[model samples]
Target chain A: AQSVAQPEDQVNVAEGNPLTVKCTYSVSGNPYLFWYVQYPNRGLQFLLKYITGDNLVKGSYGFEAEFNKSQTSFHLKKPSALVSDSALYFCAVRDMGSGNTPLVFGKGTRLSVIA
Target chain B: SAVISQKPSRDICQRGTSLTIQCQVDSQVTMMFWYRQQPGQSLTLIATANQGSEATYESGFVIDKFPISRPNLTFSTLTVSNMSPEDSSIYLCSVVPGQGAVGYTFGSGTRLTVV
Candidate 1:
């Protein structure tokens, strides 16, 4: 079985400052990880993913995440935050060895980017 | 990436009533999933919709309570039957377009308020 963990319930950052939302995972096999953002009453938008290759992966809206194999973590990051970026973020993971398997989600992290 | 449209955006129904939520994708996808989000919470996988096959539900979810249908690769529906106030939740439909992409794309969601 695969599972994900988002340690923070909420994260707050000031505009122009860097931000980080932490995520970790537990999987029996290799991990396929992803990040998504959700606005109020709207569907979640794809952010980025870490499948293989480099530890650093860049994604939509100038966001990126680092995949640390040793730590079993995939942390979403942005150099500068925007007030409009405030939203709920989710981290998901699945076992790479499992074919067409459903993803397991973390509890979620609410981000509040203040101007 | 696939674009998904879900409706009835929201609905309030009396107890013992039923509601069906629809999801249509721009492109055909093999894997369609239904998830539920309670107030102020993360998402929980309800079931996986497959064409010609009955939906595969997760633990704690049953077909009698939540029925799903996948008439084609691009369309699916989820119905909540004999609903009660406990069934009130934000139900979302998601899809994985194909191999290579890491995360899932979601529909705007249906906010169901059962009274």
Candidate 2:
């Protein structure tokens, strides 16, 4: 079975400061990791994904994530947080060997960019 | 990437009534899925919508209570039967667009409130 854990339920960061939301996963085989954002009353928007390449992956809205295999983590990051960046962020993972399997998501982390 | 349009963005229904949420994709997709996001909770996979067969439901979810219909490749529907307060949540539809490894695309979501 594959599972993801977002250690923080909420993260507060000042605007223009770097923000980081932690995520870690457990899977039997190789993993496919992803990050998504959901604004108020809106659908989830894809941020970025880590399949099988570079350790660092950049995504939409000036967000990026680093996939650390040794640590079994994929933490979302932003160089400079914006007030609009505040939203619910989710980290998801699936076994790469498990073909077409549904993604197992973390509990989610609420990011608050304080002005 | 494929675009998805979901109907009934938000609804308030009486207990015991049913609500059917629809998802329409702009292009053909191989894999479509339904998920539920309870208040302040992570997204849960309800089922995988097969194009011409019965949906494959996840554990703790029954076919009788959450009937799914996938008449074609571009469209699908999920009906919530015998609605209760516990069923009040945001239902979302998602699809694996081109490749299985790429991230999935999601619909705007349907918010159901049972009273």
Candidate 3:
């Protein structure tokens, strides 16, 4: 079965600094990756996705992820972190072999942007 | 982009009772999915709700425990039956409007706390 792994449970970053939330996936075929954010008492929001074409996929709120095929990693990054950007982040993957297959998500990374 | 609205945003239910969470999408969608997010945990897909067909549940979830209904293309519901403390979690509804490895939009999850 395909699975995504977020090794870090939490990541602490200072305000205005660059931030990276690591994500790695294991799939039998090509992987379709995505990133989502969740604030307290709210639903998950779409951040970005990597279907094909560009390895570096940019998303909402100035977030981007680099899809590394060889390393099997799709890490979420932001150029300048904001205090409001602190939330729980999830990395998800879907196999490219079939269309109906549901996404497999990682354990999630809690980003705490300290002022 | 489809806008999804989920009802009963947060509810405290008693054990052995059931709670049915509704999901209404702004537009028609072919694939609707249900997921559970335990506190401080990643999402686990509960089932795929298909219109005019029985829901396809994932491992560790059953139709009896979590009955789902997809009466039409734009509406669906997931009910947590005979609830327990372990069933206390956020239930999310997701939909992918198109085919292929595209990203999905999620509703503002229903947070259920069983006691």
- On DockQ, the leading prediction is 2
Docking quality tier of model 1: medium
The alpha-carbon lDDT assigned to residue B15 of candidate 3 equals 99
Regions of candidate 3 where Cα sits further than 4 Å from its true position: B99-101
Show where candidate 2 strays beyond 4 Å.
Answer: B99-101
**DockQ per model, Cα:** 0.80, 0.87, 0.83
lDDT of prediction 2: 0.94
Candidate RMSDs in Å, in order, are: 1.3, 0.9, 1.2
Distance from true location, Cα of B29 in model 2, Å: 1.5
On residues B2-72, what C-alpha lDDT tens digit does candidate 1 reach at each position? 88989999999999999999999998888899999998888999999988899999999999999998999
User: In candidate 2 chain B, what residue range of length 10 has the lowest lDDT sum?
Assistant: B96-105
- Clashing residue pairs in all predictions, respectively, total 0, 0, 0
Q: What is the interface RMSD of each candidate, in Å?
A: 1.3, 0.8, 0.9
Ranking 2 against 3 by DockQ, winner: 2
Q: What DockQ number belongs to candidate 2?
A: 0.87
What TM-score results for chain B in every one of the models?
A: 0.96, 0.97, 0.96
Clashing pairs in 2: none
Off by over 4 Å in 1: B99-101
Residue A57 lDDT in candidate 2:
97
